[model samples]
Target: MERLKLDVLGLCETRWSGEGHFASGDKLVISSGSPDGGYGGVAVVLSAAVKNSLLSYTPVSNRLLVVRIQATHVPITIIQVYAPTSSCAAEEIDDFYEKLQAVIDAMKSRQVCVVMGDFNAKLGLGRDFESGVGDYGLGQRNERGDMLAEFCRINGLVVCNTAFQHNLRSRYTWISPDGHTRNQIDYVMISKSWFSSVLDSRARPAAECDTDHHLVTMKLRTKHFRRVRCKSMAVRPFDVTRLRNPDVSEKYSVATENRFSLLQDRYNEECTPDELWDQIQAGITEVAEEVVGRRVRKKPPKPWISEEVIALAERKRIARCTGKDQEYNDLKLEVRRRIRCDRRK
Candidate 1:
């Protein structure tokens, strides 16, 4: 969500088929759906921060998936779900929760689990206070809401948005296509232990994603974790060709020597194996960055397919658009001939 500048975003009802992860610009998308590519689906888009430190991900089914990323004190596990709609059968709903509970139980106790996305459940304000839900919820609790509440209580989670007081406009997450009815069915839930880290959570009605559901955002405070280069962001190799020059070779050698010696000086008996390995890797990388430098990526070149061929193709395109079938056909042939002649030359 570049418009909102979100680091992590949970999506529901994506309707995309299959399951996998892919890079979309600077962000990474992980999605899961039915094999037939229809009905409900869930996905998560992550920016470079969390994408870089990705630990693992599981595509449970079309309705659910899990993604884990390394964070400050502990790894953060995100479970994104597209729960069964209220109109769905009771058996389907029960099955969804059973699988969800299994997923939650599999997570480590030390990990910070964040369960979020469209639950299709309306958790409303109750008479007193609810364990998982807060008093500031909207509307009135329904059957689906009761089930969600019970699930959160069993898992020791708090519905983040319900804990905060917000106006109707910023509270409701979904609206009817006719713009009549509105409800707060989507939510961001997190473990009670990390509930304090949730600074704010609310539905952003201003976001224009052409969807009935508004974008839900949650602010969490955690120590800054350094981002590592992800697999998708492959690094270009150093320009080893420069080493052919005696001066350049000497410079690289001296820089590398200094780096290794500096690392050796800092080495301590108390340092673990991982620490020692990291130091050595960092030292080697620093030397390469300073002395060797990365090679400039080269673009594909087709000298034979020259400007003349491109101009001819443009002329053919114009002729076809002008409804001059004979002229267009002639020009197309001319373009092909020119290309062939250029290749021979």
Candidate 2:
């Protein structure tokens, strides 16, 4: 443990069960083993400071441990998971992310959620295999990247380690057990919505441990208390006409034409005007300071209001409050119908 210096160490496939003191002040909180699967178990070991903040911990599965801590009087739930190797079926990984999503959904919104462990998925940006001329060679497993991205989008989670940084070579966070090739497969994902209180997260190298995989650490600065703000207003009104002005239209056309010219020159293919516009929009959004494109909002529920509309809105709010996602959508449809009826009147 001293060699690792981890506040919380997640032994993915620990062979032993008993606890022992390490060079660092780490104590085993819980050790769980797979039913009949040898060489596959997970142990949660925490340092003195971490143990002092322990509120509760439970083993959700043989390969998973859920621990709750109160740091700085703030509550946070940390889940340690050990995923199967890369050779396993992608479906299995998808199921794992699904299960994890359910667990995260069950947690209270006020509580911060942090997941750390050997995900066995590249938290990397993939690069061209040989020359490395092309960017991006890490993160997720095959098509699992989109799946993981969707999961994060729905859950408002962020791979905290990769959220704000991406550098290659020395940036590779993991290496093969045989030390043949280097890759980053482990991750420390934080709930983007709730991790505002987190101070920092880092992954430590296990050079001295002589282990193939390294250790990940997260130092979260918790908030004393939490509160929910009252709902104020919906999205601001948008003006599509602003984008259709003569000056704006010419600029948009020129920008899009230039992008298509480059694409055509590279791919040696003709591109339609619409395709050129798409390429232009992509380039503008990619290099834009904002980084991400905003979804254009439709017109707000026809401004006109009526008694029936008010009643429908109330029902929709109740559905949302009661945690009935399907019912909430149905209520929204009904409310929209009423708005349309009122607008027609």
Candidate 3:
């Protein structure tokens, strides 16, 4: 199994609370469950190869569990969730979605997250994966299931298990409790960006066990072949505290404002309002040139009329206006007055 490079194994609704069996080569990352017992249980199993440690293990109220892993070489995270049974009420499923979204938002900085488990909802009636069984018999599409499909789309996730393309008879991930029909409920959904890493995924056939759900197996192609450059690249905790520093942020903002103001003044002197907008847009092309040529060491500051700048500006204004042009002066005063009025309102 070590040679196999199996990074992690996750199981949802494992009946027993204690450690489950693992092949001789694997190791347990963390296993969590409801403190009470049976009803809703989930577990995460990690391999010895991964460098990260379990940052947190939370078994949520809706029978959802989160295993936060912090890898050293690569910051790869796995979020496994098992939704409540479809037989449950619609409100219950909606709640599940809300909590799941919350968890996703919190884990955004993890770089890559692989979400998988028994969603207990068919994606949609007639949607296509890049490749899949045409008649994957989804029994009548339920409203909640449709919503889940929409959720996946909105979140930019792809069902990785679609590579198998097996239909209802051979494509089912779970069997109906009554043994009436097979349904493809379990899934391995990865972010569309990371979907490329899913070398292949499949719903394993029933072992000699009595369970209705088959084991969902997904092989992530995390291995990389690279020539020696640096030994490794690791991401450290970012300085989020800097965001709280008012002086730092304010200074940067002020600098940006000054730059904008300077640009605005130059634009106003050179062209009309419509032409100024055109100039700003054309400036985007110079952004690459600025960076490449190292012409600007920092981002431009916003434009502001400081006391010193105002004196120089007054000189330029006088030179541009001269003693005549009363109507132009009147128009400028009116514009300034309107700005003040709008600010007051």
Taking all chains together, each candidate's TM-score versus the true structure is: 0.67, 0.53, 0.54
Cα lDDT tens digits, model 1, 222-337, are 85365566774788888989899999999988988888888889888999999999988888888888888899997534345678787777677567557787887688678878
Candidate 2 residue-wise lDDT, 58-112, digit = tens: 6666567787777554577888787777687878776777677778878998777
lDDT of 3 by residue, 169-221 (tens): 44567876665777778777777777677777766652212257876777876
Candidate 1 segments whose C-alpha is farther than 4 A from its true place: 127-130, 227-345
| Order by lDDT, highest first | 1, 2, 3
Which candidate ranks first by lDDT, i.e. highest?
1
lDDT of model 2 at position 61: 61
Weakest ten-residue segment in model 2 by summed lDDT: 127-136
Off by over 4 Å in 2: 1-5, 15-26, 126-141, 164-170, 223-345
Report clashes for each candidate as comma-separated counts: 0, 12, 14
Write down the TM-score for model 1. Answer: 0.67
True lDDT of residue 71, candidate 2: 54
User: What TM-score does candidate 3 reach?
Assistant: 0.54
| Candidate that would win on TM-score | 1
